[model samples]
Target: MTRTGPVEIDEQTQLAARLRLVVGRLHRRIRIDGRESVPPLQLSALVTVEQHGPMRLSELARREAVSAPTMSRVLSALDEQGLVIRTPDPNDARGVQIVLSDAGAAKLAEVRSHRTALVARRLGRLDDDERRRIADALPALEALLVDED
Candidate 1:
């Protein structure tokens, strides 16, 4: 690639675009395999519960960047699928804390395993130096997504 502009787009920017394209293709392929996992936002909620332990519906909604009603609907669906359980919040009689059922945990584990295997296979094709670059960038990418507020 030739640097033709006053502001040169570095290798990092080009790699980011390539990574996005690869991710998009992988997501499409996964969907075609009848995986039918929850949407991105719902997956985030599942992860929040998994990482932070059970939380109230409103808290999950806030953390997931969705309206409370929308969270309610998502929880309802997950509940119907036996993926989540709602327990009365110990702190409040009227509130409920969403918790993952055993089934949900297993499902999440399976999905994560599948995704990891897919990425691992792709990375296996790359040279050691290329894989090392991605390994080095993981922390920076994670930091960029971290919430400081």
Candidate 2:
């Protein structure tokens, strides 16, 4: 511990720094296509619902780390726009689950495609080495993201 040539970086700090840089760059690129219209938390909520199948209001709110009332308003807006559907939960007589509508699924696909195209355009400009570096880093990045404590 005393004679180290170079101090080892803390894993948490390194991961945080990398995520910040990548997400920052990705957001900048996404903004160019008017994709920044939606707030990050709202977008995250939508993505959560889309990926997690139907979930109760409280469950969605908990996952997004927002208050139930706040999530209720968010879901209200999404519902009014026909982006989410509320269904009675099969296991709970008094509870409802929010699910993505067909329109919502289609919109999500379109938004993803736009982001993918933006990244693809930039990746197309990079040299082979840079592209390979990104591809090689993806698996480790994914594992870091999905690993549970």
Candidate 3:
């Protein structure tokens, strides 16, 4: 059911709203703490390439849920920064594949390490019970990302 007024909001709706705000704030905090030379879109693309390995431009665009032209621009910026290498696709001679360069991997690792350290420090300030509660919630948090289909 949908509520037209705040007077009738449901528990689930309130939980969803609170979770979204907290997650967004945490994400922004991490990004601010781990600000890198690469822009957010470009960094996300780089991470995708790293996860999926070398893939054709079309495949990368599809995985990233972006148009080919948009992906192309992101790749171009990464290429200019020497974060990604465009190599001729062996399977499709006419196509090019995107590969994460050594620099890209290092940058990703560095960003993650910084963010993790920041989180660790913050978590350290919490009481043991609070810390355990968050740890226990990990499974549920991860489950939230599962695709329902």
Candidate 4:
């Protein structure tokens, strides 16, 4: 059942190595293009709030792999920047929720739009065949992130 020469395994390993490099480069490029007033980590937290609606300081901290106190500081900065607001949690009257302000939403949108435009411009330079190849790989490329572990 097993074939000799390690062709399949070798090819897959090489592909994985190259893919990692390319993905990292692309991420760096996007980040550079999307630079905003907020730091990257804080921007990520803001994006999380926008994506998942309001969340608690502890919940956001946990999701961001940071301590609650650290998250509180981040939230404080965001609050000062008018990027987030504290609202009373309806279900837990004693708790507060962190919600992205309209300004924060606009900022996030602008950053993402800039990043997307960067990629779109790069993609436009590729030939039709190369573009099609990238497009054809979308499903398999997307599947890689489905179950990371």
| TM-score for all models, in order of appearance | 0.74, 0.81, 0.89, 0.87
Residue lDDT tens for model 4, 42-109: 99899889988989998899889999998998999999999999999998999999999998998888
User: Candidate 4, after superposition: displacement of residue 133 in Å?
Assistant: 1.2
What would the per-residue lDDT of candidate 1 be over residues 1-149, giving only the tens digit for each residue? 55555344576688789978976887777655536467766676778889989999989998888899999999988898888899999999998899999988987898788877777887899999999998998998788678899
The 0-to-1 C-alpha lDDT of every candidate, in the order given, reads 0.83, 0.83, 0.90, 0.90
Question: 1-149, model 3: which lDDT tens digit per residue?
Answer: 55466645576698899999999998898888776677888888999999999998899889889999999999999999899999999998898999999999999998888889989988999999999999999999999999999
Q: Weakest 10 consecutive residues, lDDT, candidate 4?
A: 29-38
> How many steric overlaps does candidate 4 have?
0
* TM-score head-to-head 2 vs 4, winner: 4
CA shift at 149, candidate 4, in angstroms?
Answer: 8.2
Q: lDDT score, residue 93, model 3?
A: 85
Q: lDDT: which is higher, 1 or 3?
A: 3
Question: Judged by lDDT against the true structure, how good is candidate 3?
Answer: 0.90
Runs in model 1 deviating more than 4 A are: 1-34, 146-149
Comparing candidate 1 with candidate 3, which one achieves the higher TM-score?
Answer: 3
Q: Supply candidate 4's per-residue lDDT for 126.
A: 98
Leading candidate by TM-score: 3
Clashes of each: 0, 0, 0, 0
